[model samples]
Target chain A: MKAKKSGGNSLFSVTAILLILLVWQIVCSAGLVSPYLLPSPVDVVKAFISDLPLLIQNARITLIEAFVGLGLGIVIGFVFAMMMDRFEPLYKAFYPLIVLTQTIPTVAIAPLLVLWFGYEMTPKVLLIILATFFPIAVSMLDGFRSADRDTIRLLESMGASGWQIFRHVKFPGALPQFFASLRISVSYAIVTAVVAEWLGGFGGLGVYMTRVRKSFSFDKMFAVIFLISALSLLLMKLVEVIQKACMPWTKTQ
Target chain B: MADLSIRDVSFSYGETQILKDVSLHLKDQELVSLLGESGGGKTTLFHVIAGVLRPDRGQVLLNGQDITGESGHVSYMLQKDLLLPYRTIIDNVCLPLLLAGMKKKEARAKAAPNFADFGLAGTELQYPHQLSGGMRQRAALLRTYMFSLSREGSPVAALLDEPFSALDTLTRQEMHRWYLGMMEKIRLSTLFITHDIDEAILLSDRICLLTGRPGTISEEIVIERPKSKRDGFAVTEEFLEYKKRILKGLKRT
Candidate 1:
């Protein structure tokens, strides 16, 4: 029964939103709140249509920041894991430092980055990387460490070198976790990018949001809010798709 | 030279001794079993001989050379399949070859012959989770064997620590039968550990009986059936007679 409801509701979910809007318009007409404080859904819709091109342009900047950070974080994480796998002392020394990076909120660190690097893309990108790097590094490190001991023995007995064991047994084992972290980091990257932009950056949706607030454009602000949510949800779904395509075995889970 | 030999091997985990003055001599083309209760030092011995754990005092020789503390002489297979869920079955099977510095395509090609050897011909493209439990075990075995023996430095001995213990009763028996059958084609010295007295009796030409709780080797029994006479019928009177004695010995220990 739950499956049936989910399927049916998914098809008609848009209708539910329309009904809510209709009720919202009725309440506004009934004068329960002032128009300046609470605009009708139609006003928000109008603002959204007019703001479409600029919103897309601003969204592009945020997407770039997020994607670049996520990509760099993934590459760096895998490389760091490999290094750690090779050197135990290095892993022991740096792992706690990596953990420490995550404990310090990116929000608190972003303004410092802005102070150091100014209001260019660097601060936003750095913030996103710091946020995304932790999960990827930790997940991939665990994956590397837990590689099949049996397989490693077999390789060594076969005269396989150390490099060979890692390439064959360890790296292959780490791929699933790598992509899982990638998905997590991608979502985190988006959030960090937005935060970085809000504090000290220009031209992204965050900056546009501050502009909309200053001009007292509440309808436009609502429209911007909707776009941000839509973009985030879409990026998360894209990651899910990539996970399926790259590692189909996880589909069972 | 015999395929493997161990002499006065002793190991401990901090204050607790694991293998107590254990010694064994094995010839090429022989399958030996180590039978004991669960938590006995059978696994500890396997790990010791595989060079995973250093024995406090011992000498291990492979093909007339000292392999004590050697990390790459004998292959080890444990209870868990340890298949890389991210990789396809074919890749898993080719792992040892890959570890030996073979190109990715070449490693997989080398494994093509054995996929059909164990009733796994069509499932190479499938991932570990997609295969049945029995099939995954087979794939894991194939991978272990290929990785250990196919490389330039072939493993002198195969150390199995309850490799089939996790399977259902019927599947475990079937795997045992299959493993025995394969022994005729590619013979190697083997040390198998199992909690089941019947399994040790059936698989090994010699059994090292271990007593748990600060585990120690308490008895060594030689299986006396001629190599030409071994079969899966389970009808051998000697095997049955010894089973009673082994169980009594374990109880006494």
Candidate 2:
């Protein structure tokens, strides 16, 4: 049943993509643009299939970087939210720092990280972490801080200790927001890993693109691009599933 | 008898005084409902009495012992039910017990008996959102009363501030009746704050009427045989007479 459902979904998306391809192919055939700049859908799919194994390999590398960085980013974000909750001065001082970090683009910082850590996984992971941290921190902070004030007051009246209030009220309230942030951050985490890999790397989809470009294999490049998109969609769907699982109350009736 | 007394209590936000030389007392297991309009400082007084806020000047005496600025001695119910939406009803109720260093298993076991008293037995595993307003209020009350600083004993007192304001008229009346029944069954002192004079009279052994933007007790009236009071009978001549007096006191401001 699950496979049937997923196959039906894939068919729907595939149909939608074929329609877009039809439009693109018509536009290109009408000499709207050169083939070099906008490859036809057939050429792209042909390129993609031939280089599937290589694309898959690079994707594995990018996925590792993204997932690892995401784990670190989530941990850091949660701890930062906790610190902000524990002390007012810390919240005031650190909130601005978080915003500052987000403004400094990971693309801008990627090269610097490569220089510092060399052309290793460290730079890619660092870039991904930097890119993904802010949303989770900001969302979780706001969620944790705004946790039903009335509930906290009621808990206080119930003789709840500070830690008890956090454990029972604030922490639970922050989950939905945290999951939302995780969803956003996951995409950013993957894209960041790809971007960092592009700067200079031996492996990852970035490197695969580089190889395809050098050989002028437009089809394989398009295939790699398709795979990357698929990967992102998969990650996003996973996060959505996790979110629903964690917050069972939010499931639609 | 556990009585609470506020002696010459005073408070100010910067130079603007809230309460000045105010005094009120509630005998053991007595319920005193406070009647006032918005910005009347009734809530501030309630906060001070509950030890959530410190009075600029005064002594909050529990059983004639100074507990001013102390914590965890009184239970409070704010305007909303403030149940942790993520937690099961039983977990929310067991919060105070866990805070007071009770083992989770033991605290939960302790809360089991009072679950049915508040008419929240089978719904213990339900999230707060699943329960109706009246049900949530009952669960909140049960949570408050099931845990005390004395390590999971019954609550000493409850401070209810417009706790039924969000409920419909019928539910509000039902909750008021339930509240009275709950208090009598538990024999806990209660300080109820409400802008509705009828509600104040309905739940209180005595009603203290306050006036002023920076409030003060402008009038006080005692309702004898309060435990035997009828619900939805606020339109009775006796109830109407008290409400009229409170309105008059309020108009003087």
Candidate 3:
């Protein structure tokens, strides 16, 4: 029954998307919008099919950067969360600073990163990490804090060590929130990599995008945008799959 | 196998005293209930007994040895089942063994046999969310029991705080019967807390009335009826007499 309901919802979503595409195509065909600025859906598709090879090549580079950075971000986030949970003073001292880091615009920091590390993959990966880690760390910390007090007390009564308590309770308890943050961080990772590449880079989807925009190949630009969105959606879907595998209890209900 | 005594334990969170001069005892293989209303510090006393929280005064003794502010001496079960959502039922029950540094395969082997005794044999591979409320509680009880098992072939005492209050009326009654049977077989010493007078009368060998602003043991009533005769005893005149006495004790406080 649940599957059927979700299937119906997805059908509606697909219909709505198709309707918007039809309207866009009509507008472009009637010359209501300049093709140079807003290419029709058909034009974008043509551009996509023609430049598929190039797009795939650039996408691979961006994906590599995104994956590497996101993996590191998750590790860093998990460590930070564990430390904050274990030490009261560290939680009090660094929680505000962690929040503050999120407020600094990734765009503003991207240039500095590029300047420091040059136009290499390091700056791009760093930017992605900076963009990705906050959500993972904050959400995981919240998950850890929200663990049932009674449950912790129970473990303590059993004479569980601090590490045992964390391994059995806090880490497992934080999983749902960790996955939630991972979904957000996954998209942030891809987008941040692209943004970083725009400033200066030899390869990647963002670099490709800049080149296309400069040449006024708007259709190609639109195609790349669609590709980026598709990639983000795919990554989010992967996260969901992994989440289901990790938390089978959630599926029983 | 275990004897637990809380001696004149007083606890306060700053100026707000939660417990004052609280003393209770559970003889080996005995079941004692701390009966009280909400905000009467039943839980506060449990925390002190569990050694998660230090009492401002007095000590917690197990087997005549001081264990005040020391954890892992007893098994503590809270109202919520608190089974880890990410783990299977067997794994959840094996947590204490794992925390005690038992090997994973050995822990599984140890916990496997007890599943059938707890009415959870087929549920070993299932997740917590897949089980009924009663089953989850049973699993939690089994987990608590595992925690109480000592290397000397003697089990430690268990501290249960309203362990079945979350279930529906029918399920709670079923659990009560099952719990009584299990207690007889296991011979575990227990310090249980409950607000329900009938529950205390039905399950406990003795009931300690904890009441007042800063909770104290107002009365200790021993149920003289044999364990075998307690089936359907809740509706008996003897049960009513005990209930009336407890109610009067609460009122006096």
Candidate 4:
């Protein structure tokens, strides 16, 4: 029953999207909107097909930067969360700082990162890490802190060591939240990489979008925008797949 | 077999005293229930006995050894089953053994045989969410039993804090039956915490009434019946008498 309900919802979502596309195509065909400003769905599709090879090449670069940055972000975030959870003093001192990092806009940070690390892949990766790590760290820390006190006491009663308590209880308890944050961080990683690339980069989807915008080829720019959305959605889906694998018990529920 | 004793234990959370001069004992293979109202420090006493909290005064002893302010001497079970969502039933039950430094393969081998005894034979490969409420409680009980196993293979005492309180009435009654049967077979000394008068009378060899602002054992009542004879005991005149006495004692407090 639940699965069927979700399936119906997805069908409605697809239909809604298609209806909007049809209206867009009609408006562009009637010359009500300039193609340069608002390309029709058909024109965007055509542009996507024509620029497929170049898009793939640039996407590969962006994906590499995103993946590398996201991986590093996860490691750093895990460490930060562990430290915060294990030590009260550290948690008190660093929790606000961690939250502060999220207040700064990614766009604002991208330029500074580019200036510091130059137009190379370094700046793009750094920007992605900066954007990605906050959610992972914060969510994981919350997860750890939210572990049931009774359960912790239960383990402690069994002569479990500090490390044992962490391994058997805290780590597993944090996984669901970790995956939740990873979904957010994954999209942040890709978007941040692209944003960083826009400022300066040898090659990436962002750099390509910048070039297309300068040439006034809005159709190509629309295609890149759609592609980025698709990529972010794909990464989020991958996170869900991994979450299922890691937490099979959730599936049974 | 092992016995547990909490002697003159007093605990406070800063200025707020939770327990005052709380002392209790569980003989080998005996079941003792701590009966009280909410905020009566039943849980605080359990925490002290479990060694998760240090008493401002007095000692917690297991088998005549002082275990005050120390953990890992007794097995503790909480209201929630607290099965790790990411692990299989076998793995979850084997947690204590793993924490004790046993190899994973060896721990699994040891725990596998007892799954049948615990009425969890086929659930070895399943996760906690796949089980019913009653089944999950049984698994948690089995895990608690596993935690109580000494290096030499003797079972220690267990501290259970409202282990079946969350279940529905039917399941709770069923759990009561199952618990009595398991206790007969294993002969584990247990200190159970609960506010339910009928449950205290049904399961305990002795019931300790904990009451007042700074909680202390206000009274102790002994039930005169063999374990096997206690089936359907809730409807008996003797059960009613005990319940009336307990209710009067609680009301007095």
Candidate 5:
């Protein structure tokens, strides 16, 4: 049942993408903007194919940074959330600061991180972790708090210890929210990885885009933009797939 | 197997007294119902008995042990099934045993034998969402039973707070019949809380009446029908008499 609905959704998404690309191509062909400034789909495709090897190399670096950052972010976020949940005083102290972290523009902090951690993967990964962990942590904390009160009571009556309550109830209860945040964080990881690279990086898609932009290679710039969007979409899809596999019960009703 | 006694328990939330001098006891192999109006502290009493809440006065005793302000002595089932959404039926049922320090494989094996008795034989691998409401309740009850049974390697009392309240009328009726059979088979000293007088009459051996602003047990109506003769007893004259007496008791409050 769910398969059919998702299939129809994909078809609609494909049609929408095609419609958007067709309109973009028409605008480019109509000379509404200079070809140098607004490359056609064909020009972007050609650029992509010609620069495939370099793009692949750069993409590999960015993906590594993103995945590492995503893993670290999830761990850190979960630990922070668990601490806040387990201790009321910690929750009172840390919750406001957690919210505050998101208020400072990530872009504004990118340069500082680059300066602190140098032009290496460390800064990029750290930036990705910062960008992605907030939503994951906050959502997880909410899920933990909103766990059915009765179930906790039930477990308590069973003589379950604190750890048992966490394992048997709180963690599993928080899973749906964790997965929900993961979708956002997966995209966030990639975006932050690239943004961090934009500040300073030896090699990555962001660096390649920077290099291409400096040379006035508009078609290649379009290629990189398309590549970044495609990567983000792919990562989001991967998270969805993992979510379905891990939470098969959700598909049933 | 052990008896449960709630002795002169009084509880208040801040200035609002919920229960005043509430006392009740569960005989071994008996099913007792605490019938009360909504917001009349039935759940609060259950929480106190289940060790989720501490009574402002008095104590809860399991067998001869004073278990006040301590949890994991009685198994509890709430209005909602409260099944873990991500777990399969078997895994959900295995939770109590798992929490009791049984190995995973051993716990799974232990829980496997009771699936047929619970009328959940074919759904061992299915998730909670895949089951009907009645089926989920059965699973929850079975989990509750397992939780109580394994807590100290003996049969323990269960506190059920409107376990069948979420079902449709027909399903609820059907569940009551199934529950009576299951109760007999498991034979855990049970305290069921319900506002439904008919349900109380249909399932419980004795019905304790709780009512009014400061909820207390105003009366206890004992059903004299033996377990073997209880089939279709809900429509019998004796059942109606018991129901009438309960209505009068509730009215007095």
Candidate 6:
């Protein structure tokens, strides 16, 4: 019954999106906004088809950076979370600083990263890592903290050591939350990679967007926007699939 | 000597006494229930016995060894199934062995044969979410059994904390029957905690009634029915006699 309700809601969402698209096309065709400023749906579609090869090539660079950054972010998050969880003093001292890191706009750091690492893949990857790791680390820390007290007690009764408690109880308990944060971080990775590339990069979708915008190719710019949306959605879906595959017990629960 | 004994164990959190001079014992292959009201220190006693919490006074003994504040002497199952959602059912069951420094293949091999005994055969590779509530509990019980098995010497005793309270009424009844049957074969010295009087009567060879603000066992009532005659025993005069005595005991608290 609940599943059917959610299914209906999603169908309604799809219709709402299609309706918005139709309204957008109508307004563009009616010349409510200048074609240069807001391309029609048809024009955007045509531009997408024409620029497909270039877009795919540039997107590949951005995607690679995103993946590398995501991997690095996960490792950093896992280690940092473990450290914070293991040491109360570390957690108390660093928790506020960790939250503070998220307050600064990631875009503000892009230029500094570019200056230090140059217009190479390194800066873009680092920017993405900086952008995405916060969610992973915070969520994982929360997960570790929120492990069921009863289960931990169970492990302790079995004569489990501190390390054994973590292996058998804390780590597994934190996984669902870790996967939830992964979905957010995966999407953040792609967006941060693009934002970083825009500040400075040799080749990527963001660099391509800057070039197209300078030439007043709004349709191509819109196409890149749509492609980025698609890519983010795709990455989020991939994470969901992997989470389901790995945590099958979550499905029944 | 009893397989497990708690000699005048008392515990407190700062000023609040959770358990006061609580002494209890379980002989070899015996199953006993600790019956009490909510917040009556049943769990505190479990924690103390499990060595997750050190008592303010007294000792926790396994096979006459004073193991107060030491862990891994007994297996414990919490109220929730507490299955690690990320691992396959078999892997969850094999966790204790893994924690004991057994190799994955060897641990899995040991856990494999008992799936049939636990009535969870063919779910070896399945995730926790794929199983029903009763099945999840079965898997948890299997995990608890494995934790005890991994230890050397006498059969591993189990400490279960209201292991069926989450289940629906019908499922709870069904599990009671299944659990009693399994106990006959496995024969682990067991300490079962429950607020449910019927449940305590149904599963325990003896029910230890815990009462008062800082709880201790007020009375111990033995159930004499053989395993074969336990079915439909709940409606019998003998069952009501025990229930009336227990209710009177609770009133005294």
TM-scores computed on chain B for all candidates: 0.91, 0.93, 0.97, 0.97, 0.97, 0.97
Tens-place lDDT digits, model 1, residues A1-253: 7779999987798889888899989888888878778888888889999999999999999999988888888778777888888999999999999998889978888989999999989888888878887888899889889987666765565566778778667776787787777767777887788888888687898888888988889889988888888887788789788867866767655
TM-score of 4: 0.90
Choose the strongest candidate by TM-score. Answer: 5
- Residue B240, candidate 6: C-alpha displacement in angstroms: 5.6
Model 4: which residue pairs collide? Answer: A159-B72
Clashing pairs in 2: A47-A219, A47-A220, A48-A219, A48-A223
Worst 10 residues of 3 chain A by lDDT: A150-159
Candidate achieving the largest lDDT: 3
CA lDDT, every model vs. true structure: 0.80, 0.81, 0.90, 0.89, 0.89, 0.89
Which pairs of residues clash in candidate 5, taking residues 3 or more apart in a chain or in different chains? A157-B72, A159-B72
Angstrom error of the Cα, residue A89, model 2: value is: 3.8
What is residue A232's positional error in candidate 1, in angstroms?
Answer: 1.1
lDDT, candidate 4, at B209: 95
Q: Write the per-residue lDDT of candidate 4 for residues B29-108, one digit (tens) a residue.
A: 99999999988898888877777788999998888989898887888888899887778999999988898899999999
Q: Between candidates 1 and 5, which one is better according to DockQ?
A: 5
Candidate 4 positional error at B49, Å: 1.2
Candidate 2 ranges beyond 4 A from true positions = A1-15, A24-43, B148-155, B211-214, B229-253
Q: Where does model 5 exceed 4 Å of error? A: A1-16, A19-33, B211-213
Docking class of 3: medium
Segments of candidate 4 deviating more than 4 angstroms: A34-38, B12-23, B36-38, B150-155, B209-222, B232-253
Instruction: List, residue by residue over A3-60, the lDDT tens digit for candidate 3.
Output: 9999999999999999999999999999998988899999999999999999999999
Model 2 whole-model lDDT (C-alpha atoms): 0.81
On residues B1-253, what C-alpha lDDT tens digit does candidate 1 reach at each position? 2388888888888998877778887877788887877667777788778777788998888887888877667766768877777678998787766655678898888789888887799998888888878888888778767755553454467777788888999998888788777766667667887888888887778887778576667788888875546674367677788888898889996
Residue-pair clashes, model 5: 2
Could you give the DockQ of candidate 4?
0.69
Deviation in Å, model 6, residue A184 alpha carbon: 3.1
| Per-residue lDDT over A1-253 for candidate 2, one digit per residue giving the tens place of the 0 to 100 score | 8779999999999999889989988987888988877788877877777767877788889999999999999999889989998899999999999999988977888889999998889999888878887888899899888887666776676667788788878887889899888988888888888888888998999887888789887667777778887888899899999888888767523
